[model samples]
Target chain A: MVEQSEQYLLTAYRETGNLQLLGRLYEPYMPLVYGLCFKYYKDEAKSEDAVMQIFESLVAKLRVHEVSNFKSWLYTLARNHCLMDLRTESRVSTVDIEEHLVESDRLLHQQYEEPITEERLALMESCLEELNEEQQRCIRLFYLEQKCYKDVAAITGYDLNKVKSYIQNGKRNLKICMERKQE
Target chain B: MNNNYLIIRIQRYLNGELSREEMYELEREALDDPLLQDAIDGYRLQQRVSHRQLSLLQQRLADRITQQTKERHAFYFGWQRLGVAATACVLMVLVLVLLWMRNHPDPQRGEKEVQVELAVPQAVGIQALPITGMAFDAEPAQGWKAFNAYLAEHMGNELPKGEVLLAFTIDEQGRPAAIRDTEGAVAELLAEAKRLLDNGPTWKGNTGKIKLIFR
Candidate 1:
């Protein structure tokens, strides 16, 4: 339902050339863009600037590119823009372009494993129940419902960083719990 | 302790914060262990959340755009008002100038033939009387023919034909003064005529540049 509404807004913005429509389309995902920028730049001001700059660029770019999934596409585009900016700035720092390329290559080459067996999946589910209330909610919303961290935070009313911490801590606890059950 | 460190490394790897070597080691480790791969999948889920704090960024951008739009509209409206006011002032000034021109006219403009009409009394008896004051009765006691006949007899046939323009002023004592003709031939005749006319009656009001055109 949300995806359909986003698609409708994207189409309306393209047809009408109304920035307000574009603004509505981008507003929900502003946190994701800012978070991604913060991860790259690490400076609060630079991250904020990057989020605004990404939207400005999106106005011209979204018109040309045929995007299927706006969220994933926007994520990749924002990451690329930040990576490029970091690459340019890295000339002044000790970080080399070769290291960035190697990291990108490693991420690209990484493959996913087969789905967990039915018995292991059952064990994981029971282990999930052992987590704290906040962790349980954050894990269910993020891993099962497939909501982004920002959406999870919005639904759970947790801070963005707190949501990430909960999910991370919960995942570790669930793994430990599952291992003990196997032993 | 090793498992805790590994979990931290997996989280960092999902965030793209892992160093190139650490990332390569993690990828190799995950490939060897199916349980570690599941943990990697869980870590990837945590990376997707966008926090509530960044909504402030969106608000600020929206405000800036709205402010710029308002300022542009105000600038355009200001110019529009100024243009309207300037046009009204120009029209008002034009109307005032037209009214002023209509009220105060040029005396020497258009008509060249100047005529001055006055109330002259008729001669009662052929005798000159001493004028007492500036004010007197303008109604004639007798007739104008006798006064004109007396002037013709004194000037004889020296009065020119065609048109003779005589200019003079009636003094405060109701006596003719500064009697002169533009044609020098009728100057003496005009003086005699003025004297006879003055004797016939007392002039009461202003007789300014009286033109006597004798044709």
Candidate 2:
């Protein structure tokens, strides 16, 4: 039903130049666009701006492109737009470097690659509970449900940066809590 | 290995930004490293938001577009109203012209005859007048006051007040033969007065063409 309505709106907009139809067609996917922007820009304001900018471009772009799956197409377009925006800004963060280094060293030295036992999984669950509410939610959605940051942001109504932070902090806290139990 | 570079690579891999070879290497490393797998899991969570946000954004965009459409519609409607008003004014002028033509047929011809009669009212006289010519009685013998009162009642506020001079003849049947020599407001008053007199009492004699002045 939704797809048919979207198709009708698309055709109507193309024929009539009615932006209202276009707006209706695009309305269902705004949060996804916002989430994608949030992921790329990691700033609430920038993400919101990106969502609006993407829509502006879509006015002309949709006319040219034969989009079969609007959701996936929109997702890719939004991601690429954000990537281009980030590239133009040239402002990559350096904070992830030290943490990545420590993680890499730990991975290389660890010998036993045992599957997580039921006991350890239980311990992990308890540790997960120990984290703050946002962190626990983000970490569970990301790790247990295998959802991406954008999805987590959409689900939780969290800003992209906040979702990422919660997950990262949650992971660290869970690790510390489990290690302490082992000791 | 520069773990910062490794982490960046992992991030890129999670974002699908990595090439095939880089992705393979990252996948291989993550297989054995539980912590690295956990990081990948955490990164993957970025893709799992609900569908509700799209609806919200759509509503906002629709509202903006709706507002714009309304403004354009209002502007167009304003111009449309002006066009309609202009058309009505032109139509009213045309109707007035048509009505005036119907009321005063062949005005130029009437004016020319009246001018000739005014130039020689005495010489042309009542005997020379055409039998078919119609005129108003300038002076009625009996009940003249009653006639005036009737004229006032019928003509209402539109009746021409003040003195009027008219040139006309009476027929053998005591009816007006012709009306002549008048212009402007007097012409209009005389035309109206002629209708009232024609419908009223008849005069007695074949009176010659006479100029009658009334106050």
Name the best candidate (by TM-score).
Answer: 1
Backbone clashes in candidate 2 total 22
After superposition, the stretches of candidate 2 with alpha carbons farther than 4 Å from their true spots are A93-183, B1-59, B70-215
Residue range B84-168, candidate 1, lDDT tens digits: 9999999999999999879977566533323221122222112222222344323222333443444434433444543334444
Query: Against the true structure, candidate 2 has what lDDT?
Result: 0.61
Tens-digit per-residue lDDT, B1-24, candidate 2? 343465466566766787655654
CAPRI-style class, candidate 1: incorrect
Go through the candidates in order and give each one's DockQ.
0.06, 0.09
**TM-score of chain A taken by itself, candidate 1:** 0.53
Model 2: per-residue Cα lDDT at residue B29: 60
| TM-score of chain A for the candidates in order shown | 0.53, 0.50
